[model samples]
Target: MAHRLLVCRIWTLSAKEIRCLPASSTAIASTSFSTSLQPSSSQVSFLSPSHGLPRSFTHTTRRQVSFNVQDNEDFTERVINSQLPVLIDFHAQWCGPCKILGPRLEKAVAKQKGRVAMAKVDIDDHTDLAIEYGVSAVPTVIAMRGGDVVDHFVGIKDDDELDSFVSKVIGK
Candidate 1:
């Protein structure tokens, strides 16, 4: 009987057309184990938490944030000459403070949305940039306006402080 049940479960998962099965079969199908093993359907996927709209019908889009600075030339073009104010986060991978502050800063910048942009610089990777910026510490955040350093702060700041910093950088 157990072998028959196993075969039924496998068959049910393989057959995508079988929806609204009998209550007896549903007892097995409703189990968490069977749910994950079921084949994925591309025909209609849900995007919203309520599963309200089909994936194609959803109007939501994502925004880009926290870009990495590739090189000195990239920096000059993206940050220095940018029409919008840029917030540069000077961080090192091994630095604990940097790991903590990076996400917090990104969250704060995201709150301001397109009003400001964030650039992350790895001090170890781009030592020259760090040296040029006079960053002697890990997690140094600098605000740039028109290619010049307008304001800066060192160490970790809470979300509220970061929000305020972003506001000041954008002159809000």
Candidate 2:
């Protein structure tokens, strides 16, 4: 009886046609196929009617408050010439403290709306920018306005401290 039940379940699953439906019309669509035997809770897959293969969909969108600095020219063009005060985050990919501090700094900047912008510089990628700004360590944050350095700090700071630091940088 147990064997019969197991075979029946497999037969039902194999016979049923699954359709993938968009969660919402507003969401951006990207296509991917999964071949896993089991699906995780967060992921759902359905067989396409035409293709007879498992399909997955996900949607994501986020507002931009910060940008990664590409090179010396990009740094000069975006950070040094900006009308709003710009915060330069000099960091390295391998630095643990930099990983912890990057998001906190971006959150702090986000709270300020459009009053300030953030420039992320990877010390490994843009060594010239880091050296030019006198950054000898990871997670160095520098605030500048009117093409001049106004304030800076090194190391990781908590959420409240970051908010205060950002506020101070904007002189608010």
Candidate 3:
């Protein structure tokens, strides 16, 4: 059914999203299966930045996109409902700090995949949410537990600080 395919697509997307994190690459070769993948026809071709080499995707066709506006939508379900603590990156596309914040967010999310759920919002897209949350600035990073706003920081914080905060709040 179409619904099943969409669920599959979403899961595949989630996997690809996870692999995009920086740490996963270093762990790839030790798996021992890296040398055995036969080149397949379904792969899409692209260039690799790290090695300055050409590469092909055996899967994935992620169109350019961003997270949708969420309003009157139960963010509690989206966040607290996760089996893990949740980190929501309140961002607008045009904010400069937001640009700098992404890689770090990705790194954190990668490091805590099963332990945390990461969601992003575009303030421009969700004016209601922006107003409701009193998010007058971009790049506000908030951490939530049990569907409630426990604490948050604006702009960038060192990894150690973030790690410690997560540990304290999530009881890790």
Tens-digit per-residue lDDT, 1-172, candidate 2? 6546634443345323222334431121112323455454433323334445433346666679999998888988999999999999998889999989999999999999889999999999988787888998889999999899999999999999999989998983
Kindly report which residue stretches of model 2 are placed more than 4 angstroms away from their true locations once superposed. 1-61
lDDT of 1 by residue, 1-172 (tens): 7757755554545233334445555445334223344464422222112443222346867787779999999999999999999999999999999999998998999899799999999999999999999999989999999888999999999999999999999993
Q: All candidates' TM-scores?
A: 0.68, 0.65, 0.55
Model 3 stretches with alpha carbons more than 4 Å out: 1-71, 74-76
> Candidate 3's residue-wise lDDT over 1-172, tens digit each?
6546644443455445534645443243223222335454332222123333223468976432223336545565676575667777888888888888766765655665356666787778777776777777888877777777777878877777766765665663
- Candidate number of the best lDDT: 1
Query: What's the distance in Å from true for residue 32, model 1?
Result: 13
Quote model 1's TM-score: 0.68
Task: Give the distance in Å from residue 94's predicted Cα in candidate 3 to where it truly belongs.
Answer: 0.6
**Candidates by lDDT, descending order:** 1, 2, 3
Of 1 and 3, the candidate ranking higher by TM-score: 1
